[model samples]
Target: MTNFNGFQKLIAIANEYGIICYATPEECLVASLPGYDDFLLAFSWSGAFEGEPPEHELIAISIQDITKEVTVAAWQIPTYLFGNVLRQAQMLVTAHQDFVLRTNNP
Candidate 1:
């Protein structure tokens, strides 16, 4: 089974920042603004459903509502190194201005 620890950390960070994190069979989606495509972040996992080693690639989709902007960012991780990518993702989400704390975990 794909390791979920990394995903858990991502969720924790999202919650701490008041972002909504949703996990599905294919990937995880994080969003800070409701009904706004510009504030949505999607993390697509390589080995999400199959029982195999975790794939080290993340597809970050950023939508810019103003000016009709859309950006696609791709980061590749070496084998057995997903934590760094997770941290980077968290940092990216936290940099947004509309962030809020969504969890009470200390």
Candidate 2:
């Protein structure tokens, strides 16, 4: 079970990657990133359920108006790897945020 602090770290990471992360009652985390012109990378994740457990997966979608394109990538990570990914993402976000901050500051 992840604590609030951990979740906050995840959000920070997403922000750094120029992605937006939102939480829904049904979905644990939803991440979205705009790519190129209209293309986008959207991903959602659900840790575990009450009765039946679901696998941890990542999905990437590409939107191109009428010609819609989609790609999916799913994988299961061990409990140990979960923290590492989360931390890495957080580090990326922190670095991105720092870069932007420095660039904007005179």
- Worst-scoring 10-residue span by lDDT in model 2: 58-67
lDDT of 2: 0.42
Indicate the residue-level lDDT of 13 in model 1: 52
lDDT of each: 0.47, 0.42
Cα RMSD of all models vs. native, in order, equals: 11.3, 12.0
lDDT winner among the candidates? 1
Q: List TM-scores for all candidates, in order.
A: 0.37, 0.35
For every model shown, the clashing-pair count is 3, 0
Model 2, TM vs. native = 0.35
Name the top TM-score candidate. 1
Kindly report which residue pairs in candidate 1 clash with one another.
17-100, 18-100, 18-102
Candidate 2, superposed: residue stretches over 4 Å from native: 36-71, 76-106
Superposed Cα deviation of residue 37, candidate 1 (Å): 5.5
Q: What local lDDT score does residue 49 receive in model 1, on the 0 to 100 scale? A: 32
